[model samples]
Target: MEITVHSSKSVKPDYGDSSNGDAAFASADVVPLSVFDKVNYDEYIFYVYAFHPPSPPTTVLVPALAKTLAEYREWAGRFGVDGSGNPAIVLSDAGARFIEATAATEFAGSVKLLTTGDKVLSLYPICDGAEELLLVQATRFRCGSLVLGFTMHHKVADGPGMWNFMVAWGQVTRGVAIDPVPVHDRTSLFARQRQDSPAQVKFEHRGAEFKPRAGGEIPGVSCGNVAVHADGEEVVVHRVHFTREWITELKSRASSNRGGAWSCTTLQCVAAHLWRSVTEARGLGAREATRIRVAVNGRARMKNPPVPEGYTGSVVLWAWPATTARELLRRPLRYAVELISREVARTDDAYFWSFVDFASSGAVERERLVPTADAAEVPPCTNVDVDCLLAIPFAKLDFGCGPPFFFRPGYSPAPVAGAIYVLKSFEGDGGVDAYVPLFSRTMDAFKKSCYSLTPPMADARL
Candidate 1:
């Protein structure tokens, strides 16, 4: 399990092409953080993809990375602030950090390397600073396997945005023109420009994305981003696989009690299943209130001037669905599915604009609010937090080499919070892959009930 670093350097974008030259982004050019991006200013997302040895060499890969950055200039930019002191990305072409490393062992025997903590994390570059918006590490094994790891600040882009960037990079590596050029205009796409009073807004913005001020706490409820873990607890990021057939059956079971009126979507069914199983695993009291935070994309949901297809920025919000353990577990699966569906159904254009309006009202800065991810830490299994990334075309991320055999976070975010990231499995079996982090104490219970699609009998113990 030995890893040796061979080289590390900043790869600046190559603006050789006059069409999109570096002059477009002067040293002072900056992109202000949108309302969606501001909330994730303190967060960083990590990912790792494994490829077989016949992978492209650094000679081809590094240049492709720099060429790709020319188009994705924002990634090579550094963090800064605008005149009003709001968070912004200074497009100064500061360059992204890239490293080349070698591993002493084979990829198959590297399971221990993927266990947890600093071991697997070593594969990715450290992005806990403002100097670099994107950091990448390429680790090569003796058997010709390569592990590509990268980290990006959440404020720069969310899951969908990152996917767009990665797919473009892959296209560049293969010597193809990047299809569907990225749209960097976040202000107009996600921010509200029209003048509007906070009182005119429909939904209550306080205590949702922004933390409420004095005397605004929700009695006993915690923020959606709040997660608490036991002292010295061992958290493991485990994969829970749900085959296509399993999901189909689960959908059937969830809609069985609905009398054919409506059926739950794939995510709704899967999320409900996860929430119920995690609640049982935690062994929460029957009366204890538990909630699941589901992430909803706002790209297609926005209208007027609909969000462009390739807008690269964070535009996602959470849909919080809550119920007592007794009700969530005792009721039919459809009950939990419906609760989630209702929330997601309502989180549309109006809801997104309302949130934008709240931010535009200066309330976010006035209240000195902090996002839940920046709030008190907790275990993810304590309350399920689900983000579905199934639509990300991971299989199509070919870089002259074959598609990646595996794609996952370089390291689990278990230490910070317990969470689940659902992605498409690389097995080509149409199975769903859920990257879940749970405390060792409840891992066994979760594994036992994770695949069970049916609701337990009212009197049955999990």
Candidate 2:
């Protein structure tokens, strides 16, 4: 496949002093601060796939690519913002290369984009291997020859906001005008803090010190942030689908256990199930201990009324629950659900705020505040290493087109055995998509666990 590059048609905004009665800094026009800014992290990555029924003629693919770019430009014009909060229409060099390189390759292979300082640029091809992650590749066996893949930063927008941007781009590409432009009003949900608050959450960045103790053997698999060395050799991803009815039942069970706390219960139950499955796969008894962390978005749960949906500020809170994997599996599912529910509920209480304040004040050492394995004792013998589940709502994201066919969050290798569960609406049914990154050696075990869920087959490149 061949790829080409082009200069972005967008322009940069000037930061000169203003005259007239207008305030020098207008809140409405300024780039809204995102919650990502407060969190120390790298970029957020996402992938999009566009499939054609059969290998469209080269004629169709080329023009379609061009139209897509034009549409992207228009969408960027309306929704894109610069660091200074101006009508920034330009794509970073990386963004430009992302679009161009995909086109040149005829949508084959992955494009790696990196952010350095304030600039985003595309790094050249890192591998000629099979398409994994965001790399797009074409195959003769499939009728659809081209797909679009993208990796962008979470600092730019949330899932809903990103969907809105994509829908706008789609409409533009289809040569239609989008009416009733989507609002970016997130003022209530993610309001910016007047000043920087010191980090309240802490983790012992053990780096590579921790060793896997799954049945006295470690799996041989390694990703950028995680590694497994063992006696196994296959890696695959299974997408599991759950019916809306099943989800409702799960939710109902969770509510009954928690006296009506919804999201927390649903998430905790799922996490518990996953943990149990991993432990069982490794022939570990139900009583082995494990810990799983759940990310909680604090915007809506804060003492103050939530920021508006369009508010693009930082308002996320997180929780880590440490318990024996055996204990989680021994109790009724509701017990685990209730445990999660109560933990999440505590974050909204004043006590949680006090903890945050105390931690920030340096009264508590980072080690004391963060979760740590009991070094004095042998680490709990557990099959599952570690897991994190995120349950953010992304269905109402309408940019005047419709919902997306697939939405996958970026993968993190830092957490040994991490997975992201997303609720996707398909044919008006709520389906759950779990994005998991595992040690390559445990591929068979992972597949077995996913097969039990029986999710429909959709396009999963990574």
Q: TM-score winner among the candidates?
A: 1
State the lDDT of candidate 2 residue by residue for 1-462, as single tens digits: 333443222222212321112132222333443333223123344444434434344334334333433322222222356676533323321122223233433322322221101001122222223121122222221223344445444444544444445444445435455322444433323332646643343432221112223233233444332333344333233345556677666556545645554454445656655655554444444444555555555545556444444332334444555566456545555666666666666656343344344434543344333222211122233423322333333333322223333333333322234343444433356555454444455546656764343321222210
* Regions of model 1 farther than 4 Å from truth: 21-28, 111-119, 128-130, 191-200, 213-230, 379-382, 410-413, 457-462
Candidate 1 lDDT, 319-396, residue by residue in tens: 888888899989889899999999988888888888887777877667777676443245234578887887776667
Backbone clashes in candidate 1 total 6
For all candidates in order, the CA lDDT equals 0.76, 0.39
Error of 2 at 335 (Å): 1.7
Lowest summed lDDT window (length 10), candidate 2? 112-121
Candidate 2 has a TM-score of 0.54
User: Which predicted model would earn the best lDDT?
Assistant: 1
